[model samples]
Target: MGLLTERGELEAERLTPAGERILRAASTLFYERGIRTVGVDAIADAAEVTKKTLYDRFGSKDRLIAAYLEQRNRVWHAFLDDQLAALAPQTPADVILALFAALTDWMAESRRGCGFINASVELAAPDHPAMPVIVAQKQWMRSEFMAQAALGGFADVQELADRLLLLHEGALVCFRVAAMEYAPEVAHRAAADLLAGWPRD
Candidate 1:
Protein backbone atom coordinates (compact mmCIF):
# COMPACT_ATOMS: atom_id res chain seq x y z
CA MET A 1 0.00 0.00 0.00
CA GLY A 2 1.01 3.62 -0.49
CA LEU A 3 2.31 5.63 2.47
CA LEU A 4 -0.89 7.63 2.78
CA THR A 5 -3.01 4.49 2.87
CA GLU A 6 -0.65 2.56 5.16
CA ARG A 7 -1.69 4.13 8.44
CA GLY A 8 -5.44 3.87 7.73
CA GLU A 9 -6.05 7.00 9.76
CA LEU A 10 -6.55 10.57 8.49
CA GLU A 11 -5.20 10.07 5.00
CA ALA A 12 -4.44 13.19 2.98
CA GLU A 13 -6.96 12.28 0.32
CA ARG A 14 -9.75 12.21 2.87
CA LEU A 15 -9.21 15.83 3.84
CA THR A 16 -11.40 18.61 2.43
CA PRO A 17 -9.84 21.64 0.73
CA ALA A 18 -10.11 23.68 3.90
CA GLY A 19 -8.89 20.78 6.01
CA GLU A 20 -5.93 20.37 3.70
CA ARG A 21 -5.08 24.03 3.99
CA ILE A 22 -5.44 23.89 7.74
CA LEU A 23 -3.20 20.85 8.00
CA ARG A 24 -0.55 22.26 5.70
CA ALA A 25 -0.40 25.47 7.67
CA ALA A 26 -0.49 23.69 11.01
CA SER A 27 2.27 21.24 10.06
CA THR A 28 4.69 23.99 9.05
CA LEU A 29 3.89 26.15 12.06
CA PHE A 30 4.03 23.27 14.50
CA TYR A 31 7.44 22.20 13.28
CA GLU A 32 8.94 25.66 13.05
CA ARG A 33 7.45 27.22 16.15
CA GLY A 34 6.35 24.21 18.24
CA ILE A 35 3.06 22.56 19.16
CA ARG A 36 2.62 24.30 22.48
CA THR A 37 3.49 27.75 21.21
CA VAL A 38 1.30 27.85 18.10
CA GLY A 39 -2.41 28.44 18.48
CA VAL A 40 -5.46 27.60 16.33
CA ASP A 41 -5.93 31.25 15.53
CA ALA A 42 -2.43 31.46 14.11
CA ILE A 43 -2.97 28.29 12.08
CA ALA A 44 -6.25 29.59 10.69
CA ASP A 45 -4.62 32.88 9.74
CA ALA A 46 -1.72 31.12 8.04
CA ALA A 47 -4.10 28.87 6.14
CA GLU A 48 -6.19 31.90 5.20
CA VAL A 49 -9.22 30.46 6.92
CA THR A 50 -11.33 31.70 9.79
CA LYS A 51 -11.20 30.30 13.33
CA LYS A 52 -14.66 28.78 12.80
CA THR A 53 -13.37 26.91 9.76
CA LEU A 54 -10.35 25.69 11.66
CA TYR A 55 -12.52 24.41 14.51
CA ASP A 56 -15.01 22.91 12.08
CA ARG A 57 -12.20 21.11 10.27
CA PHE A 58 -10.15 19.92 13.23
CA GLY A 59 -12.62 20.06 16.12
CA SER A 60 -10.01 21.46 18.51
CA LYS A 61 -6.36 22.41 18.89
CA ASP A 62 -5.47 19.06 20.40
CA ARG A 63 -6.76 17.11 17.41
CA LEU A 64 -5.02 19.55 15.11
CA ILE A 65 -1.74 18.78 16.86
CA ALA A 66 -2.38 15.07 16.39
CA ALA A 67 -3.13 15.62 12.71
CA TYR A 68 0.12 17.56 12.36
CA LEU A 69 2.05 14.65 13.83
CA GLU A 70 0.27 12.18 11.59
CA GLN A 71 1.16 14.28 8.57
CA ARG A 72 4.77 14.42 9.74
CA ASN A 73 4.85 10.64 10.08
CA ARG A 74 3.77 10.29 6.47
CA VAL A 75 6.46 12.71 5.30
CA TRP A 76 9.15 10.92 7.31
CA HIS A 77 8.18 7.50 5.98
CA ALA A 78 8.17 8.82 2.43
CA PHE A 79 11.66 10.26 2.90
CA LEU A 80 13.01 6.92 4.15
CA ASP A 81 11.30 5.09 1.28
CA ASP A 82 12.98 7.37 -1.24
CA GLN A 83 16.36 6.92 0.46
CA LEU A 84 16.03 3.13 0.54
CA ALA A 85 15.11 3.02 -3.13
CA ALA A 86 18.08 5.14 -4.14
CA LEU A 87 20.55 3.30 -1.87
CA ALA A 88 19.18 -0.16 -2.85
CA PRO A 89 20.61 -1.91 0.16
CA GLN A 90 21.65 -5.50 -0.62
CA THR A 91 20.85 -7.07 2.73
CA PRO A 92 18.65 -6.52 5.75
CA ALA A 93 21.67 -5.31 7.68
CA ASP A 94 22.45 -2.92 4.86
CA VAL A 95 18.84 -1.72 4.98
CA ILE A 96 19.21 -1.03 8.69
CA LEU A 97 22.39 0.93 8.13
CA ALA A 98 20.82 2.72 5.19
CA LEU A 99 18.23 4.18 7.57
CA PHE A 100 21.03 5.65 9.67
CA ALA A 101 22.70 7.00 6.53
CA ALA A 102 19.41 8.64 5.49
CA LEU A 103 19.33 10.52 8.80
CA THR A 104 22.19 12.78 7.69
CA ASP A 105 20.22 14.05 4.73
CA TRP A 106 17.03 14.19 6.78
CA MET A 107 18.76 16.28 9.45
CA ALA A 108 20.40 18.49 6.87
CA GLU A 109 17.04 19.28 5.33
CA SER A 110 15.67 20.35 8.71
CA ARG A 111 18.02 21.23 11.54
CA ARG A 112 15.09 21.35 13.97
CA GLY A 113 15.52 17.57 14.50
CA CYS A 114 12.78 14.96 15.08
CA GLY A 115 9.33 16.53 15.24
CA PHE A 116 7.93 13.67 17.30
CA ILE A 117 10.60 14.10 19.95
CA ASN A 118 9.95 17.82 20.11
CA ALA A 119 6.20 17.25 20.40
CA SER A 120 6.69 14.67 23.13
CA VAL A 121 8.68 17.16 25.18
CA GLU A 122 6.18 19.96 24.67
CA LEU A 123 3.05 17.87 25.22
CA ALA A 124 3.74 16.88 28.81
CA ALA A 125 0.31 15.38 29.45
CA PRO A 126 0.31 11.59 29.14
CA ASP A 127 -3.39 11.72 28.37
CA HIS A 128 -2.96 14.31 25.64
CA PRO A 129 -4.71 13.46 22.38
CA ALA A 130 -1.48 13.59 20.40
CA MET A 131 0.51 11.49 22.85
CA PRO A 132 -0.32 8.21 21.16
CA VAL A 133 0.76 9.48 17.79
CA ILE A 134 4.08 10.64 19.24
CA VAL A 135 4.69 7.35 21.01
CA ALA A 136 3.67 5.29 18.00
CA GLN A 137 6.10 7.13 15.77
CA LYS A 138 9.04 6.17 18.00
CA GLN A 139 7.73 2.65 18.47
CA TRP A 140 7.51 2.18 14.73
CA MET A 141 11.21 2.91 14.41
CA ARG A 142 12.06 0.32 17.04
CA SER A 143 9.75 -2.19 15.40
CA GLU A 144 11.40 -1.60 12.04
CA PHE A 145 14.81 -2.15 13.57
CA MET A 146 13.73 -5.39 15.17
CA ALA A 147 12.13 -6.63 11.95
CA GLN A 148 15.31 -5.90 9.99
CA ALA A 149 17.50 -7.55 12.60
CA ALA A 150 15.33 -10.67 12.47
CA LEU A 151 15.47 -10.70 8.68
CA GLY A 152 19.25 -10.54 8.82
CA GLY A 153 19.34 -13.58 11.12
CA PHE A 154 20.81 -11.57 13.91
CA ALA A 155 21.03 -12.95 17.43
CA ASP A 156 19.03 -11.19 20.12
CA VAL A 157 17.01 -9.08 17.75
CA GLN A 158 15.13 -7.39 20.56
CA GLU A 159 18.28 -6.29 22.30
CA LEU A 160 19.80 -5.14 19.01
CA ALA A 161 16.69 -3.12 18.17
CA ASP A 162 16.76 -1.45 21.58
CA ARG A 163 20.41 -0.50 21.15
CA LEU A 164 19.86 0.80 17.62
CA LEU A 165 16.88 2.89 18.76
CA LEU A 166 18.92 4.45 21.58
CA LEU A 167 21.68 5.38 19.14
CA HIS A 168 19.15 6.77 16.68
CA GLU A 169 17.20 8.86 19.21
CA GLY A 170 20.39 9.93 21.00
CA ALA A 171 21.78 11.32 17.75
CA LEU A 172 18.53 13.24 17.12
CA VAL A 173 18.61 14.73 20.64
CA CYS A 174 22.28 15.61 20.43
CA PHE A 175 21.83 17.26 17.06
CA ARG A 176 19.18 19.69 18.33
CA VAL A 177 19.52 19.83 22.12
CA ALA A 178 23.31 19.72 22.32
CA ALA A 179 23.98 21.37 18.93
CA MET A 180 26.18 18.56 17.61
CA GLU A 181 26.59 19.47 13.94
CA TYR A 182 27.99 16.08 12.93
CA ALA A 183 25.62 14.02 15.05
CA PRO A 184 23.94 12.11 12.23
CA GLU A 185 27.26 11.24 10.58
CA VAL A 186 28.57 10.06 13.91
CA ALA A 187 25.44 7.94 14.34
CA HIS A 188 25.85 6.41 10.91
CA ARG A 189 29.42 5.34 11.69
CA ALA A 190 28.44 4.01 15.09
CA ALA A 191 25.60 1.96 13.56
CA ALA A 192 27.93 0.57 10.92
CA ASP A 193 30.39 -0.53 13.60
CA LEU A 194 27.60 -1.99 15.70
CA LEU A 195 26.26 -4.02 12.78
CA ALA A 196 29.73 -5.25 11.87
CA GLY A 197 30.31 -6.56 15.38
CA TRP A 198 26.77 -7.84 15.98
CA PRO A 199 26.50 -11.61 16.28
CA ARG A 200 24.57 -13.46 13.60
CA ASP A 201 22.37 -16.48 14.07
Candidate 2:
Protein backbone atom coordinates (compact mmCIF):
# COMPACT_ATOMS: atom_id res chain seq x y z
CA MET A 1 0.00 0.00 0.00
CA GLY A 2 1.30 3.46 -0.91
CA LEU A 3 1.46 6.11 1.78
CA LEU A 4 -1.24 8.66 1.12
CA THR A 5 -0.14 12.31 1.19
CA GLU A 6 -1.93 13.23 4.40
CA ARG A 7 -3.74 11.16 6.96
CA GLY A 8 -6.94 12.35 5.34
CA GLU A 9 -10.37 11.66 6.79
CA LEU A 10 -11.56 9.56 3.87
CA GLU A 11 -13.62 6.79 5.37
CA ALA A 12 -15.36 5.25 2.35
CA GLU A 13 -18.26 3.87 4.33
CA ARG A 14 -18.95 7.19 5.99
CA LEU A 15 -19.09 9.01 2.66
CA THR A 16 -22.26 10.96 2.03
CA PRO A 17 -24.28 10.68 -1.16
CA ALA A 18 -22.52 13.81 -2.26
CA GLY A 19 -19.16 12.15 -1.71
CA GLU A 20 -20.29 9.05 -3.60
CA ARG A 21 -21.29 11.39 -6.41
CA ILE A 22 -17.76 12.75 -6.46
CA LEU A 23 -16.31 9.22 -6.63
CA ARG A 24 -18.65 8.22 -9.43
CA ALA A 25 -17.81 11.29 -11.45
CA ALA A 26 -14.11 10.87 -10.81
CA SER A 27 -14.15 7.23 -11.90
CA THR A 28 -15.77 8.13 -15.21
CA LEU A 29 -13.66 11.19 -15.97
CA PHE A 30 -10.36 9.65 -14.88
CA TYR A 31 -10.96 6.57 -17.01
CA GLU A 32 -11.99 8.57 -20.09
CA ARG A 33 -9.32 11.23 -19.72
CA GLY A 34 -6.10 10.13 -18.03
CA ILE A 35 -5.73 10.99 -14.33
CA ARG A 36 -3.29 13.88 -14.80
CA THR A 37 -5.37 15.39 -17.60
CA VAL A 38 -8.48 15.65 -15.41
CA GLY A 39 -8.06 18.53 -12.96
CA VAL A 40 -9.62 18.87 -9.53
CA ASP A 41 -11.88 21.63 -10.77
CA ALA A 42 -13.06 19.44 -13.63
CA ILE A 43 -13.88 16.64 -11.21
CA ALA A 44 -15.73 19.09 -9.02
CA ASP A 45 -17.75 20.31 -11.98
CA ALA A 46 -18.54 16.79 -13.09
CA ALA A 47 -19.54 15.76 -9.58
CA GLU A 48 -21.61 18.95 -9.10
CA VAL A 49 -19.66 19.73 -5.95
CA THR A 50 -17.64 22.79 -5.10
CA LYS A 51 -13.84 22.48 -5.09
CA LYS A 52 -13.87 23.16 -1.38
CA THR A 53 -16.07 20.14 -0.73
CA LEU A 54 -13.91 17.97 -2.96
CA TYR A 55 -10.80 18.97 -1.02
CA ASP A 56 -12.65 18.69 2.25
CA ARG A 57 -13.44 15.07 1.45
CA PHE A 58 -10.36 13.78 -0.41
CA GLY A 59 -7.58 16.31 0.38
CA SER A 60 -5.65 16.24 -2.92
CA LYS A 61 -5.96 15.26 -6.58
CA ASP A 62 -3.38 12.53 -6.06
CA ARG A 63 -5.41 11.01 -3.24
CA LEU A 64 -8.46 11.15 -5.45
CA ILE A 65 -6.62 9.24 -8.20
CA ALA A 66 -5.44 6.68 -5.70
CA ALA A 67 -8.99 6.21 -4.52
CA TYR A 68 -10.11 5.76 -8.13
CA LEU A 69 -7.45 3.13 -8.78
CA GLU A 70 -8.31 1.32 -5.58
CA GLN A 71 -11.96 1.22 -6.52
CA ARG A 72 -11.17 -0.01 -10.03
CA ASN A 73 -8.79 -2.61 -8.67
CA ARG A 74 -11.43 -4.14 -6.45
CA VAL A 75 -13.87 -4.50 -9.32
CA TRP A 76 -11.32 -5.92 -11.77
CA HIS A 77 -9.87 -8.40 -9.26
CA ALA A 78 -13.32 -9.71 -8.51
CA PHE A 79 -13.91 -10.31 -12.22
CA LEU A 80 -10.61 -12.09 -12.67
CA ASP A 81 -11.11 -14.17 -9.54
CA ASP A 82 -14.55 -15.26 -10.57
CA GLN A 83 -13.35 -16.29 -14.03
CA LEU A 84 -10.27 -18.09 -12.68
CA ALA A 85 -12.32 -19.80 -10.02
CA ALA A 86 -14.54 -21.32 -12.67
CA LEU A 87 -11.54 -23.20 -14.05
CA ALA A 88 -10.97 -25.20 -10.89
CA PRO A 89 -11.11 -29.05 -11.04
CA GLN A 90 -9.64 -28.93 -14.55
CA THR A 91 -6.01 -29.48 -15.56
CA PRO A 92 -3.86 -26.39 -15.29
CA ALA A 93 -3.60 -26.31 -19.05
CA ASP A 94 -7.36 -26.15 -19.27
CA VAL A 95 -7.47 -23.51 -16.57
CA ILE A 96 -4.93 -21.42 -18.47
CA LEU A 97 -6.99 -21.68 -21.61
CA ALA A 98 -10.08 -20.72 -19.66
CA LEU A 99 -8.25 -17.68 -18.35
CA PHE A 100 -7.55 -16.59 -21.91
CA ALA A 101 -11.19 -17.09 -22.77
CA ALA A 102 -12.08 -14.77 -19.92
CA LEU A 103 -9.58 -12.24 -21.21
CA THR A 104 -11.16 -12.47 -24.64
CA ASP A 105 -14.56 -11.79 -23.12
CA TRP A 106 -13.12 -8.84 -21.22
CA MET A 107 -11.60 -7.37 -24.41
CA ALA A 108 -14.91 -7.62 -26.25
CA GLU A 109 -16.19 -4.80 -24.08
CA SER A 110 -15.48 -1.30 -25.42
CA ARG A 111 -13.01 1.17 -23.86
CA ARG A 112 -11.58 -1.36 -21.43
CA GLY A 113 -7.81 -1.80 -21.54
CA CYS A 114 -5.49 -2.90 -18.73
CA GLY A 115 -6.07 -0.01 -16.29
CA PHE A 116 -2.81 -0.39 -14.34
CA ILE A 117 -0.73 -0.39 -17.54
CA ASN A 118 -2.51 2.72 -18.77
CA ALA A 119 -2.08 4.48 -15.44
CA SER A 120 1.65 3.70 -15.27
CA VAL A 121 2.23 5.47 -18.59
CA GLU A 122 0.13 8.47 -17.64
CA LEU A 123 1.65 8.99 -14.17
CA ALA A 124 5.30 8.79 -15.44
CA ALA A 125 6.55 9.64 -11.94
CA PRO A 126 8.37 6.75 -10.25
CA ASP A 127 7.24 7.68 -6.75
CA HIS A 128 3.74 8.64 -7.81
CA PRO A 129 1.30 7.35 -5.15
CA ALA A 130 -0.46 5.27 -7.80
CA MET A 131 2.67 3.24 -8.56
CA PRO A 132 2.47 1.01 -5.50
CA VAL A 133 -1.10 -0.02 -6.17
CA ILE A 134 -0.33 -0.74 -9.83
CA VAL A 135 2.76 -2.71 -8.89
CA ALA A 136 0.77 -4.81 -6.44
CA GLN A 137 -1.84 -5.59 -9.06
CA LYS A 138 0.78 -6.74 -11.58
CA GLN A 139 2.60 -8.81 -8.97
CA TRP A 140 -0.60 -10.50 -7.89
CA MET A 141 -1.58 -11.23 -11.50
CA ARG A 142 1.76 -12.87 -12.29
CA SER A 143 1.70 -14.86 -9.07
CA GLU A 144 -1.77 -16.10 -9.88
CA PHE A 145 -0.59 -17.16 -13.35
CA MET A 146 2.35 -19.01 -11.83
CA ALA A 147 0.20 -20.73 -9.25
CA GLN A 148 -2.14 -21.90 -11.97
CA ALA A 149 0.78 -23.37 -13.91
CA ALA A 150 2.01 -25.19 -10.81
CA LEU A 151 -1.41 -26.66 -10.17
CA GLY A 152 -1.53 -27.84 -13.77
CA GLY A 153 1.46 -30.08 -12.89
CA PHE A 154 3.98 -28.17 -14.98
CA ALA A 155 7.54 -28.69 -13.71
CA ASP A 156 8.74 -25.41 -15.24
CA VAL A 157 6.12 -23.11 -13.72
CA GLN A 158 8.40 -20.08 -13.83
CA GLU A 159 9.11 -20.40 -17.53
CA LEU A 160 5.43 -20.84 -18.31
CA ALA A 161 4.69 -17.77 -16.25
CA ASP A 162 7.30 -15.76 -18.12
CA ARG A 163 5.91 -16.78 -21.48
CA LEU A 164 2.30 -16.14 -20.45
CA LEU A 165 3.20 -12.76 -19.00
CA LEU A 166 4.66 -11.76 -22.33
CA LEU A 167 1.67 -13.13 -24.19
CA HIS A 168 -0.79 -11.45 -21.83
CA GLU A 169 0.92 -8.05 -21.85
CA GLY A 170 1.47 -8.21 -25.58
CA ALA A 171 -2.19 -9.01 -26.09
CA LEU A 172 -3.16 -5.96 -24.05
CA VAL A 173 -0.77 -3.79 -26.12
CA CYS A 174 -2.35 -4.99 -29.32
CA PHE A 175 -5.80 -4.34 -27.95
CA ARG A 176 -4.85 -0.82 -26.89
CA VAL A 177 -3.20 0.27 -30.14
CA ALA A 178 -4.83 -1.66 -32.95
CA ALA A 179 -8.18 -2.13 -31.19
CA MET A 180 -7.65 -5.80 -31.96
CA GLU A 181 -9.20 -8.45 -29.73
CA TYR A 182 -7.77 -11.29 -31.80
CA ALA A 183 -4.58 -11.29 -29.74
CA PRO A 184 -6.39 -13.37 -27.15
CA GLU A 185 -7.15 -16.05 -29.70
CA VAL A 186 -3.63 -15.93 -31.11
CA ALA A 187 -2.02 -16.05 -27.69
CA HIS A 188 -4.34 -18.79 -26.53
CA ARG A 189 -3.43 -20.93 -29.52
CA ALA A 190 0.26 -20.40 -28.93
CA ALA A 191 -0.13 -21.28 -25.25
CA ALA A 192 -2.09 -24.40 -26.11
CA ASP A 193 0.65 -25.48 -28.46
CA LEU A 194 3.29 -24.91 -25.81
CA LEU A 195 1.38 -26.90 -23.22
CA ALA A 196 0.83 -29.72 -25.72
CA GLY A 197 4.56 -30.21 -26.04
CA TRP A 198 5.38 -29.90 -22.34
CA PRO A 199 5.71 -33.15 -20.38
CA ARG A 200 3.10 -33.50 -17.63
CA ASP A 201 4.51 -34.31 -14.23
Candidate 3:
Protein backbone atom coordinates (compact mmCIF):
# COMPACT_ATOMS: atom_id res chain seq x y z
CA MET A 1 0.00 0.00 0.00
CA GLY A 2 3.06 2.28 -0.45
CA LEU A 3 0.80 4.91 -1.91
CA LEU A 4 -2.38 3.42 -0.53
CA THR A 5 -0.45 2.44 2.60
CA GLU A 6 -0.16 6.16 3.16
CA ARG A 7 -3.91 5.93 3.53
CA GLY A 8 -3.40 3.98 6.75
CA GLU A 9 -1.74 7.11 8.08
CA LEU A 10 -4.55 9.53 7.21
CA GLU A 11 -5.44 10.10 10.85
CA ALA A 12 -1.83 10.98 11.57
CA GLU A 13 -1.86 13.30 8.57
CA ARG A 14 -5.33 14.72 9.03
CA LEU A 15 -5.86 17.74 6.84
CA THR A 16 -5.93 21.28 8.09
CA PRO A 17 -8.74 23.64 7.04
CA ALA A 18 -6.58 24.72 4.12
CA GLY A 19 -5.74 21.13 3.34
CA GLU A 20 -9.45 20.37 3.18
CA ARG A 21 -9.85 23.17 0.68
CA ILE A 22 -6.99 21.76 -1.39
CA LEU A 23 -8.59 18.30 -1.43
CA ARG A 24 -12.05 19.59 -2.35
CA ALA A 25 -10.61 21.77 -5.07
CA ALA A 26 -8.51 18.95 -6.44
CA SER A 27 -11.43 16.53 -6.35
CA THR A 28 -13.58 18.79 -8.50
CA LEU A 29 -10.86 19.76 -11.01
CA PHE A 30 -9.44 16.26 -11.31
CA TYR A 31 -12.83 14.69 -11.79
CA GLU A 32 -14.39 17.39 -13.97
CA ARG A 33 -11.26 17.90 -16.01
CA GLY A 34 -8.99 14.97 -16.77
CA ILE A 35 -6.47 14.18 -14.03
CA ARG A 36 -3.52 14.82 -16.34
CA THR A 37 -4.89 18.14 -17.51
CA VAL A 38 -5.42 19.71 -14.08
CA GLY A 39 -2.10 21.07 -12.92
CA VAL A 40 -1.07 21.67 -9.31
CA ASP A 41 -1.03 25.40 -10.00
CA ALA A 42 -4.65 25.25 -11.05
CA ILE A 43 -5.63 23.26 -7.99
CA ALA A 44 -3.68 25.52 -5.68
CA ASP A 45 -5.33 28.57 -7.20
CA ALA A 46 -8.76 27.02 -6.90
CA ALA A 47 -8.10 26.01 -3.33
CA GLU A 48 -6.89 29.57 -2.63
CA VAL A 49 -3.62 28.25 -1.30
CA THR A 50 -0.04 28.77 -2.34
CA LYS A 51 1.61 26.11 -4.51
CA LYS A 52 4.01 25.58 -1.61
CA THR A 53 1.10 24.92 0.70
CA LEU A 54 -0.29 22.35 -1.72
CA TYR A 55 3.08 20.71 -1.87
CA ASP A 56 3.35 20.82 1.89
CA ARG A 57 0.11 18.91 2.18
CA PHE A 58 0.18 16.55 -0.80
CA GLY A 59 3.90 16.35 -1.61
CA SER A 60 3.24 15.87 -5.34
CA LYS A 61 0.52 15.57 -7.97
CA ASP A 62 0.63 11.77 -7.74
CA ARG A 63 -0.02 11.84 -3.99
CA LEU A 64 -2.82 14.34 -4.50
CA ILE A 65 -4.41 12.09 -7.10
CA ALA A 66 -4.23 9.13 -4.74
CA ALA A 67 -5.85 11.18 -1.99
CA TYR A 68 -8.65 12.19 -4.34
CA LEU A 69 -9.47 8.58 -5.16
CA GLU A 70 -9.32 7.58 -1.52
CA GLN A 71 -11.68 10.42 -0.71
CA ARG A 72 -14.03 9.44 -3.53
CA ASN A 73 -14.02 5.82 -2.47
CA ARG A 74 -14.82 6.82 1.10
CA VAL A 75 -17.83 8.94 0.15
CA TRP A 76 -19.08 6.44 -2.41
CA HIS A 77 -18.89 3.56 0.03
CA ALA A 78 -20.73 5.55 2.68
CA PHE A 79 -23.49 6.31 0.19
CA LEU A 80 -23.78 2.63 -0.79
CA ASP A 81 -23.79 1.51 2.82
CA ASP A 82 -26.54 3.95 3.65
CA GLN A 83 -28.61 2.79 0.71
CA LEU A 84 -28.23 -0.87 1.60
CA ALA A 85 -28.88 -0.28 5.30
CA ALA A 86 -32.08 1.56 4.50
CA LEU A 87 -33.16 -1.37 2.36
CA ALA A 88 -32.67 -3.91 5.13
CA PRO A 89 -36.33 -4.75 5.68
CA GLN A 90 -37.09 -5.01 1.99
CA THR A 91 -36.86 -8.09 -0.21
CA PRO A 92 -33.34 -9.14 -1.15
CA ALA A 93 -34.14 -8.55 -4.82
CA ASP A 94 -35.11 -5.00 -4.05
CA VAL A 95 -31.91 -4.47 -2.09
CA ILE A 96 -29.70 -5.96 -4.77
CA LEU A 97 -31.41 -4.24 -7.69
CA ALA A 98 -31.22 -0.80 -6.10
CA LEU A 99 -27.79 -0.45 -7.69
CA PHE A 100 -29.17 0.71 -11.03
CA ALA A 101 -31.40 3.34 -9.51
CA ALA A 102 -28.47 4.47 -7.39
CA LEU A 103 -26.33 4.76 -10.50
CA THR A 104 -29.06 6.73 -12.22
CA ASP A 105 -29.14 9.22 -9.38
CA TRP A 106 -25.37 9.42 -9.07
CA MET A 107 -24.81 9.89 -12.80
CA ALA A 108 -27.52 12.51 -13.00
CA GLU A 109 -25.67 14.56 -10.42
CA SER A 110 -22.09 13.63 -11.39
CA ARG A 111 -22.44 14.38 -15.08
CA ARG A 112 -18.67 14.61 -15.49
CA GLY A 113 -18.54 10.76 -15.39
CA CYS A 114 -17.30 8.05 -13.09
CA GLY A 115 -14.43 9.44 -11.06
CA PHE A 116 -12.58 6.14 -10.75
CA ILE A 117 -13.10 5.29 -14.39
CA ASN A 118 -11.85 8.70 -15.41
CA ALA A 119 -8.77 8.17 -13.24
CA SER A 120 -8.16 4.77 -14.77
CA VAL A 121 -8.29 6.21 -18.28
CA GLU A 122 -6.26 9.32 -17.50
CA LEU A 123 -3.62 7.40 -15.56
CA ALA A 124 -3.05 4.41 -17.81
CA ALA A 125 0.15 3.13 -16.25
CA PRO A 126 -0.47 0.00 -14.22
CA ASP A 127 1.87 1.25 -11.51
CA HIS A 128 0.25 4.65 -11.22
CA PRO A 129 -0.31 5.69 -7.59
CA ALA A 130 -4.05 6.05 -8.04
CA MET A 131 -4.46 2.62 -9.64
CA PRO A 132 -4.68 0.73 -6.37
CA VAL A 133 -7.39 3.02 -5.06
CA ILE A 134 -9.44 2.45 -8.21
CA VAL A 135 -8.90 -1.31 -8.00
CA ALA A 136 -9.94 -1.39 -4.35
CA GLN A 137 -13.12 0.57 -5.04
CA LYS A 138 -14.16 -1.87 -7.79
CA GLN A 139 -13.27 -4.94 -5.77
CA TRP A 140 -15.29 -3.59 -2.83
CA MET A 141 -18.28 -3.20 -5.13
CA ARG A 142 -18.09 -6.78 -6.39
CA SER A 143 -17.64 -8.03 -2.85
CA GLU A 144 -20.68 -6.06 -1.71
CA PHE A 145 -22.70 -7.63 -4.51
CA MET A 146 -21.58 -11.07 -3.35
CA ALA A 147 -22.69 -10.35 0.20
CA GLN A 148 -26.08 -9.09 -0.96
CA ALA A 149 -26.54 -12.00 -3.36
CA ALA A 150 -25.85 -14.50 -0.62
CA LEU A 151 -28.35 -12.82 1.68
CA GLY A 152 -30.81 -12.72 -1.20
CA GLY A 153 -30.70 -16.51 -1.31
CA PHE A 154 -29.81 -16.54 -4.97
CA ALA A 155 -29.31 -20.07 -6.31
CA ASP A 156 -25.92 -19.06 -7.60
CA VAL A 157 -24.64 -16.20 -5.49
CA GLN A 158 -21.28 -15.81 -7.16
CA GLU A 159 -22.72 -16.05 -10.66
CA LEU A 160 -25.51 -13.69 -9.79
CA ALA A 161 -23.12 -11.22 -8.20
CA ASP A 162 -20.87 -11.42 -11.25
CA ARG A 163 -23.74 -10.72 -13.65
CA LEU A 164 -25.08 -7.92 -11.50
CA LEU A 165 -21.62 -6.39 -11.20
CA LEU A 166 -21.27 -6.62 -14.97
CA LEU A 167 -24.57 -4.84 -15.36
CA HIS A 168 -23.39 -2.17 -12.96
CA GLU A 169 -20.10 -1.71 -14.81
CA GLY A 170 -21.85 -1.82 -18.18
CA ALA A 171 -24.37 0.78 -17.11
CA LEU A 172 -21.62 3.17 -16.04
CA VAL A 173 -19.69 2.62 -19.25
CA CYS A 174 -22.85 3.18 -21.25
CA PHE A 175 -23.64 6.32 -19.32
CA ARG A 176 -20.16 7.70 -20.00
CA VAL A 177 -19.16 6.27 -23.39
CA ALA A 178 -21.61 4.17 -25.38
CA ALA A 179 -25.34 4.75 -24.85
CA MET A 180 -25.64 7.92 -22.82
CA GLU A 181 -29.36 8.10 -22.37
CA TYR A 182 -31.54 5.20 -21.24
CA ALA A 183 -28.51 3.31 -20.02
CA PRO A 184 -29.37 3.02 -16.36
CA GLU A 185 -32.97 2.17 -17.03
CA VAL A 186 -31.93 -0.43 -19.56
CA ALA A 187 -29.53 -1.91 -17.06
CA HIS A 188 -32.20 -1.93 -14.39
CA ARG A 189 -34.57 -3.80 -16.65
CA ALA A 190 -31.85 -6.22 -17.61
CA ALA A 191 -31.07 -6.77 -13.92
CA ALA A 192 -34.71 -7.60 -13.32
CA ASP A 193 -34.58 -10.04 -16.16
CA LEU A 194 -31.51 -11.64 -14.69
CA LEU A 195 -33.22 -11.84 -11.36
CA ALA A 196 -36.18 -13.54 -13.00
CA GLY A 197 -33.98 -16.04 -14.78
CA TRP A 198 -32.10 -16.98 -11.64
CA PRO A 199 -34.58 -18.07 -9.04
CA ARG A 200 -33.47 -18.08 -5.40
CA ASP A 201 -34.00 -20.88 -2.93
User: Which stretch of 10 consecutive residues in model 1 shows the poorest summed lDDT?
Assistant: 1-10
Order by lDDT, highest first: 1, 3, 2
* Candidate number achieving the greatest lDDT relative to the actual structure: 1
Model 2 global lDDT (CA atoms, 0 to 1): 0.75
Q: For model 3, where is the 10-residue window of minimal lDDT?
A: 1-10
| lDDT digits (tens) for residues 1-201 of candidate 1 | 221113433455478899999999999999999987898889999999999999988889999998889888888888988988888888889888989999999999887988999999999999999998888888888888898899899999999999999999999999999999799999889999999999999
lDDT of 3 by residue, 21-114 (tens): 9999999999888899999999999999999999999899999999998888777655666665655536667766776667777778788668
Between candidates 2 and 3, which one is better according to lDDT? Answer: 3
lDDT of model 3 at position 154: 81
Backbone atom clashes (below 3 Å) for every candidate: 0, 0, 1
Clashing pairs in 1: none
Q: How many backbone clashes does candidate 1 have?
A: 0
Which has the greatest TM-score? 1
